[model samples]
Target chain A: EPEVTQTPSHQVTQMGQEVILRCVPISNHLYFYWYRQILGQKVEFLVSFYNNEISEKSEIFDDQFSVERPDGSNFTLKIRSTKLEDSAMYFCASSKKTETQYFGPGTRLLVL
Target chain B: AQRVTQPEKLLSVFKGAPVELKCNYSYSGSPELFWYVQYSRQRLQLLLRHISRESIKGFTADLNKGETSFHLKKPFAQEEDSAMYYCAFRSYNTDKLIFGTGTRLQVFP
Candidate 1:
């Protein structure tokens, strides 16, 4: 089965540095999302994208966060500056319609 | 505001035993419920959704709107059923999903 794929399975960055996480959702899916899970915590929604625009975002997705579909096949999340608290496992997901979301293996981000 | 709640952090069952994972929600509008499973070293995947009203892999869940609950159940637990299960709630207003803390089911053979 076709699944969502994310690059840089694990990332380490200095505090205040910028990092861009990339994802390639299922080719035919229309809706894309970014969610993060703090260690031993529930997964939290960050943002949703459709038609090259953000549909909705959570409070955690503040000024430092931005999402882009720079090209047809890629969906990327950029954090302008990283903080110690920002370290988490980020998962990218997509759904054929708007119901069942298929998640990627997740990218673990560690801030130093 | 919408929230999904999975009260149990861990549950264990032996082979051939029955298992039920409880989930509850708080949402004003109509809600869609889903059960997702993440096995060790595997991506989180959907197990089943209430809308389908169908069983998959001997597992089933019923959406009880009156009780604000959607609990996943299985008749005969198998070793392969061991996984981390998350209950998720999505409102029609938005496609974003709110997930519960999750329940780790350990099925011993």
Candidate 2:
């Protein structure tokens, strides 16, 4: 079955540096989303993207976070300034419809 | 606000025993419920959705509107069934999914 794919399975970055997590959602899917799970915490929604624009975002998705669909196949999340608390497993998910999202393997981000 | 609650953080069962992972939700409107699983060293994936009402991998869940719960159950579980399970729900107005804290199931031989 076709699945969502993410690049840089693991990443380590300086606290103040910028980081971009990349994801390629299923080709035919229309809606895309980003979620993060802190170690030993529940997965939390970050943002949702559709039609090249952000559809919804959580309070945690503040000024530092931005999502882009730079190309037809790539969905990227950029953090302007990484904070220690930002370290978590970031998951990318997509669905043809609004329900039943398929998730990627996730990119583990560590901001030291 | 919408929320999902998975009561048990960890559950262990011997092989061939029945297993049930409890999940409860607080949503006023009609909800869309789902069970997602992540096996060791694997990505999180969908196990089943309540809307379909189909059993997957010998697991089935019944949506109880009265109790506002969707508990996943499996009879005579096998060792391979061990994994981390998350109960998730999405409200009708939004596409975002609110996930529970998750329950880790360990089936020992």
Candidate 3:
């Protein structure tokens, strides 16, 4: 079965540095989303995207976060500056319609 | 306040035993409920959704709107069924999932 794929399975960056996490959702899915789980915490939604624009976002997705579909097959999340609290495993998901979503292996981001 | 609650952090059972994972939600609008499983080294995968009203892998869940709950159940558990299960809730037009912390099921032989 075709699944979502993400790059840099693990990432480590210094605090205050910028990092871009990449994902390639299932080729035919129209809706894409980004969610993160801090260690031992519930997975929290960051943002949802469709038609090259953000559909909805959470409070945690503040000024530092941005998402882009720079190409037909790629969806990317960029964090302008990292903080210690930013360390978490970020998952990318997509769906053909809306509710049921498929998830990627996830990129574990560790901000030092 | 939209939230999904899986009260139990861990549930253990033996082979051939019955299993039930509890889940409750708080949402003003109608809620779409789903169960996602993540095995030891695997990514989260859909187990089943309440709307389907079908059983998968001998497991089934019923959406009790009156109780505001969607609990997953299996009459006979197999060792291979061990995994982390997350109960999720979504509102129409919300497009995002509100997930419970997750329940880890350990089915032993």
Poorest stretch of ten by lDDT in candidate 1 chain A? A93-102
Clashing pairs in 3: none
Ranking of predictions according to DockQ: 1, 3, 2
Model 2 spans > 4 angstroms off: none
Q: What are the per-residue Cα lDDT tens digits for candidate 3 across B1-109?
A: 8999999999999999999999999987888999999999899999999999889899999999999999999999999999999999999878999999999999999
Task: TM-score for candidate 1, please give it.
Answer: 0.98
Contacts from the true interface found in each model, as a fraction, amount to 0.97, 0.85, 0.91
Clash list (residue pairs), candidate 1 = none
Worst-scoring 10-residue span by lDDT in model 2 chain B: B89-98
lDDT of 1 by residue, B1-109 (tens): 5789999999999999999999999997889999999999899999999999989899999999999999999999999999999999999888988999999999998
Q: Candidate 3: which stretches are off by over 4 Å?
A: none
**Native contacts present in candidate 2, fraction:** 0.85
Candidate that scores best on lDDT: 2
Angstrom error of the Cα, residue A19, model 3: value is 0.6
- Is candidate 1 or 2 superior in DockQ? 1
Tens digit per residue, CA lDDT, model 3, A17-79: 999999999999999999999999998999999999999999999999999999899999999
Best by DockQ: 1
